[model samples]
Target: MDSQAISVEILKWMLEVQCKEALVPALLYEKKVRSQYGKAENVQPVKGVLSKRALQVNAPGRDIYGLEKSTEVRYFECPNCERQVAGHRFAAHIARCSGRGRR
Candidate 1:
């Protein structure tokens, strides 16, 4: 029929022939040709069968220190001043200071 159907038939015949050693080289060549010019879909699973979902239910939250849920601002030690400053404002303040230093 179509190229896809033909490819699938060829694959099935190859498997039935027990051509394992030839399969790898054939697959590699197929991949190379597909990479340059797209190939056709060959195999199709049985109809009316739904594929399994990839995502998991009841996944853990990303709270490393159990503080991610907290509303309190996290503080970080400033490299230039060695003082504790709010994490959010630290970078902006550092940029301002550096810009002032350059003037």
Candidate 2:
């Protein structure tokens, strides 16, 4: 073995003889060294199988304002904004649109 390896073994042995707490530092160093130089595999991420259409809840449920989910409602696309506002809130939404108010 090289001089560095010999000294490492000697240091570890001395720590073991000095006190029980001294061995903790040597053990932690050994763990870190092994982790840095150990053989490890290249990992790849997996893609989920869920689609956007599968996530919508079309079942009948009442909103806080007593609005039924199954009822037909109008939706408006703002001329100056990217948001698609519901019919009831479209007028208010267009009045306060970020794209319309700010330059």
Candidate 3:
């Protein structure tokens, strides 16, 4: 391994030792290592089917906001400031833009 990889592995070992000795919280060590080194290159992401319990509990449906999912995003150009605003927020944008003096 190169110097940088070696250093990261050494740091990980030190963090684990500190965690085992109760000098640092296990959660903190996990968070620090994750935030700094990210995922290990040797580990492969597992792809599998979800459990029946997970499927039942996490059944996909309309979001809590009750708005149906629309994949397409539409943009409208503001006549006053000539800024492109998202379709959902266009009304509010127009109100604010129209209230101000045109450049």
Query: How close is every model to the real structure, measured as TM-score?
Result: 0.31, 0.26, 0.31
Candidate 1's TM-score: 0.31
Deviation of model 1 at 61, angstroms:
13
Regions of candidate 1 where Cα sits further than 4 Å from its true position:
1-69, 100-103
lDDT of 3 by residue, 5-102 (tens): 99999999999987788855766888899999996578554579665555555556634454455688999999988999999999888877877535
What local lDDT score does residue 80 receive in model 1, on the 0 to 100 scale? 77
Give the candidate number with the greatest lDDT: 3
RMSD of 2: 15.5
- Per-model RMSD to reference: 16.3, 15.5, 13.3
The better-scoring model by lDDT among 2 and 3 is 3
> Arrange candidates by TM-score, highest first: which order?
1, 3, 2
Pick out the ten consecutive residues of candidate 2 with the lowest summed lDDT: 51-60
**Which residue pairs overlap in candidate 2's backbone?**
none
Each prediction's number of clashing residue pairs: 0, 0, 0
* Predicted candidate 1 versus true structure: per-residue lDDT over 1-101, tens digit per residue: 99999999999998877876778789999999999988677878768864443112222442444333556799988777788889889887787666764
Comparing 1 and 2 on TM-score, the stronger one: 1
Worst 10 residues of 3 by lDDT: 59-68
Best by TM-score: 1
Off by over 4 Å in 3: 1-68, 100-103
Q: Model 1 Cα displacement at 45 (Å)? A: 21
